[model samples]
Target: MFDILVIGSINADLVFISDIRPKAGETVMGKDFKVLPGGKGANQAIAAARLGKKVGFIGCVGNDDNGKKLIENLRGNNVETQYIQIVDDVPTGVANIVVAEEDNSIIVIPGANYSISKDMIDKNMDILLNSKLILLQNEIPMEVIEHIIDLCFGKDIKVILNPAPAVKLKESIVNKIDYLTPNEHECKIAFGNPNTDGLLTKYPNKLIVTVGDKGVLYHDGNKKVNIPAFKVDVVDTTGAGDSFNGAFAVAIVEGNSLYESLLFANKAAAISVTKIGAQEGMPYLEDLKGL
Candidate 1:
């Protein structure tokens, strides 16, 4: 059985480096362009796999060269991609990433990712129910996420969701997630009311709020605390959060204390930002040992 199961979109990322983001209707010559195998789900899967988790991926890719390469890349990282379905109708997902100095902006074309049906989630429900942990991101259809959450109910498995690219999930599903990781923007988007607001207060289980640079905030019932980020010279920080979430799951599954897991995750993410590419920048166990 997989230690962790991930269900979300899959894509190849086209990353470009520019002195600054080009203004709308203005074209600036980019300094460099680099292509990398990435997708929020793919990145997280590799992140966890690199941290020694038996991670299985459930998503779709195109039947084209990109799809074949995408599967090969995941397998190269030891992330199980046998369940990655290839469809001819829609091309593989693609993320157009532009790095403006230290910051970056992205525009994604879901392609085959959008066709990952609810039925697929139902069929793979067993994988998630049996997993020690399941990581989720908003790259897939909401129904897919909902089905997985519903099926994992009362099971031994834990669900760790990073509500990225920010979308509010159905309240019922929110109540079911074992853990929720939302960045500052996502945190604000999940809750609008100041009285009964705060994603932590709304959820019955664990919730973690990640603030870039300032660090992460972990809240479980009456307990809440902050975990500071490791100091590093950041380059392109596209997949730092994905790395952190994946590493967090690995540390937790390995029986590390929550604080320790988060600290380790923080370091892993810090290391990721210092380099370029998503999975390419991800550090291995020995690399973290040096930190």
Candidate 2:
């Protein structure tokens, strides 16, 4: 069985890097533009696979050249793509990422990714049931994620939900997830402000707020744990959180304590930001050992 299974969107990222972000109806000369194979699911899968974990990906790709290219990329990286479905009518998902010196913005046209569903998950039931860790993100329909969670709810699988490009989700998912990984904004939108007093004493089983550069904060069942981020020269912050989740899952599967896992994951994410592309930036197990 694979150590980690990721169910989410797969997209070709067309990035435009500029010194500063553009305002509405204004155009400026761009500094750089590059296309890379990306998407949260694919990024996480590649991250774990390169770190020496057996990983599998389940997502939909359109019957197009980009789709075909992404499938090839995953296979070359040692991530199993047999469960990734191909949709006939819709085009492959595409994410237009605009990276400014200070921050970034993204607009995704889900395309075939929106077509990903529970039926597809059923077809890959054995794969889902056997994996040690199930990693999911909000890129897929929330209902589809809930369906998978319900199936693995009582089973031995541990569900790691990363709510990014953060949006509203139902209480069903909030109550059931074993671990919820959210960025600072997502944490505020999902729960209240992180600065709230006694946040751990409140509905403590659910969340882990990932604060970039600052580190991570978790409300464990009893106490809150603060995990600091490693210092590194950041090039592109894109996909850093995904790297964190992937490394965290792999560490957990290898039986590391939560503190150790968070530290290991933080280092992986720190290294990821120092490079440009998403999957291309992830540090391997040997690198992690040195960290």
Q: What does candidate 1's lDDT look like per residue over 52-137, in tens digits?
A: 88999999999999999999999999999888889987899999999887988999999999889888877776676778988989
lDDT of each: 0.84, 0.85
Cand. 1 Cα-lDDT:
0.84
1-291: candidate 2 lDDT, tens digit per residue: 889999998999999999888899999888999999989888988888888899999999999999999999999999999888899999999999998875678898888888998888999999999999999988889889889989988788989899876776666777777788888788666664555325444546457778878898876676787888888777888889889989988988898877788888898998888888787788888876655
What TM-score does candidate 1 get on C-alpha atoms? 0.94
Scored by lDDT, the top model is 2
TM agreement with the true structure for every prediction: 0.94, 0.94
Worst 10 residues of 1 by lDDT: 191-200
On the 0 to 100 scale, the lDDT of residue 216 in model 1 is: 82
Candidate 1: list runs displaced more than 4 Å: 193-198, 201-205, 220-223
Candidate 2: worst-modelled 10 consecutive residues by lDDT: 192-201
